[model samples]
Target: MAVTFYYAPYSTAESTKAILAELEHGLPNPLATRIELSISAGDTRKPAYLSDVNPNGRVPAIVHDGVPIWESAAITMYLGETFGVRAGNDPHQSSLYPEPGPRRGEAMKWIVWTNTTLTVAGARLAAALPVGTPGAVEKGSQDEVSKDETARKNEEEIARGDLAKNLKVLDEALKERNYLLGDQYCLADTHVWTFVSWLSVMGVSTEEYLHLTEWLARVGARPALKDQ
Candidate 1:
């Protein structure tokens, strides 16, 4: 069966593309088609994509042989385990999913934390930043930091502070472990790195968090992640 990956560059969809790349790089994977959507052309918001692919009308969606899946975090876990089965490995023992054990539990923990807490805080910070302020990396996708179209006072200290709290938690969590789940690289690393790389856009410097900096280098060094 073929997988149809709907995407837009430099968006959250890159994380899902990274997973697909990793699976294919490691073995003869089931990853088949990659459909690049244009956020500028309103591709993601189109009627067909909204109805059949993602009801939420977002990129980074997957239609694995017609069954649709959305949400990058959910897609990460889905592909991690499902691709393992297609590769003749037990889903519970999947390399990306980390078998069923403590590592798996930790993976679940960090994934939920990144999606719910980290991303929420970051979005708030991005929303509060001034419309044309520079420093966000130009990773090919359109910048939404300026989407606060209505003129408003940008006293961004509060939003920045909230995100700082979350980042510090991540810093402390990674002070000792190599990855979110100890030393082994797994799905959590893949999912978390997706947004963590956008700290430049949030006006957050990584120099304060040494562990996070090193971890980014480590994860970003992976061969499969070069393009996506």
Candidate 2:
């Protein structure tokens, strides 16, 4: 049976979609069936969606053989292992995911770091930014902040500083190779690239980091990421 992918447009689920897209290039067709959930319309709150798919009421969840899996990183890792595309220690088979060795260990480290630490930093930065759309406030805001404007600006500035520090670390990491792990694109790239794309969309300038910018262009050229 094909895995069922729950996604919402303009959401973090795009990372999951990109990973699946890359897998589909060389793997079997119908690897997963997509179900677009209208998150902005409150489709995720429906009882059926909550009870059957993801109890947390979030997009980018997946159901495979009756088992539900949340978290975009986990979904990508699952797909990588299930499809036999993960890079192994055998210097023969090439894959996006490294096998159980040094390369694989490096890949695992970055994946976890991206999903946890980096994700938190991104959320903090995003939370501190002004709402792009009129009348739209922060995630949990019941109304616009008319009085705490100064406080919010300070927070945003601090968040931007922290995000820049994190970006510098990533920029330096890319100085030695094209991708996160090395010359070859790995699952770590998928996770990190998603954040980079999000940062770009959030109006963060990539021009400052030449190596990182070049790396983004290379990975962004992938057909799977083009539409995403």
Candidate 3:
């Protein structure tokens, strides 16, 4: 049976889907499954949809054969292992996810950091913007901020504080190398890029993060990420 991924464009789930698209070998494009079914986050709260798989109603969940997988990290791990590209397995692709070593630990650190830091911070920032502003392009913005100007400003300040702290962390990390875990690109890079790339769309600036800005440009140049 084919693996099917339910995705919502521009959502945090895009990170895993983007990585799958960039796999060097063996990884199946879950999007291509002929029997694939999709339920965008826009409608995932429906009773019928959430009952069968993902009771929490999260997007980017995948159903492989008859088994359901929720959570982006779990999905990524499953895909990597299923394709024989898990760390310590494929030497050629090992650079992306190296064996049990400092590099691998570094990769995992950044991956978790991105999910908890960048993802959360970005969500806050997006949630802070005016409902009709450009930042409202993401999910939470519209609901959190309506036409009220004062409330929007308050949310914006709180969100900016959180986002700035994490962005600085990323900026400092980039000073040492092009990617998070060192010279090689790995899940860390892919995961963080998904949200950092959204800064410009939200009217945020990366001028202070020169290294991160440059690295993002390099990542943008990648052929595989072009599909994202």
Candidate 4:
């Protein structure tokens, strides 16, 4: 049976959509069937979705052969393994995933780091600013402004600093390699690149990090992204 992909427009589900496109690029048959959910319209809050697919009522969940998986990173990893594109148990074996050993360990490390640390930092920063202007919120609201706006402004400043620090760390990590794990493009790149791309769309400039900027350009050019 084909996998069932639950997604919402303009959400993080775009990452999953990209991964699916990549898989279809390599496979002869379709990997999954997409089901659009309107979160703004409260589609996720429906009883069927809440109980049957994702109890958490979130987008980017998948159902494979009756098994449900949520979280973008986990979904990507699962797809990689199921497709036999993941790194093999033997370091010398050829696969999309790094072979087992320090290389594989490094891949896992970056995957977790991108999903947790980087994802959280980017989200916090994005949440503070207004919908259309990321990281560009005013430092302080007018004297008559409500406390909520003031709090948002304060949060924006803090989040901006945090985002800068996180980006720097990523910049340093990419200085010596073309991809996150050396030359080969692994699943970790999919997770990290998605978050980084989100920042780009949010008006975060990556020019200061030359290597990362180039990397984003390379990955963004993939046909899978174009399909989305």
Our tally of clashes for model 4 stands at: 1
Error of 4 at 144 (Å): 22
Question: In candidate 1, which residue ranges exceed 4 Å CA deviation?
Answer: 28-30, 84-94, 131-155
> At residue 67, what lDDT does model 3 achieve?
84
Give candidate 4 misplaced runs (Cα > 4 Å).
84-94, 131-147
- In the predicted model 1, the residue pairs found to clash are none
Q: Rate the local accuracy (lDDT) of all candidates.
A: 0.74, 0.75, 0.67, 0.74
User: TM-score of each candidate?
Assistant: 0.83, 0.86, 0.80, 0.85
Q: What's the lDDT of the predicted structure labeled candidate 2?
A: 0.75
lDDT of 3 at 68: 82
Candidate 4 local accuracy as lDDT? 0.74
Quote the lDDT for 146 in model 2.
Answer: 45
* Candidate 4 backbone collisions, by pair: 87-97
Pick the TM-score winner. Answer: 2
**Which 10-residue window of candidate 4 scores lowest in summed lDDT?**
136-145
Candidate 1 positional error at 35, Å: 0.7
Candidate 3, residues 1-228, lDDT tens digits: the string is 367677666565677677667664344433334222333334566685588667876676777877888777667656654642455545555344455577767766777777677767667767767555675644442235344778768877887888888888888989978787667777667767876877667877887888889888878777778657
88-205: candidate 1 lDDT, tens digit per residue: 5455434766666776678878888888998876666655555445533232334454434344234366666777888788888888888887877887888888778866655687
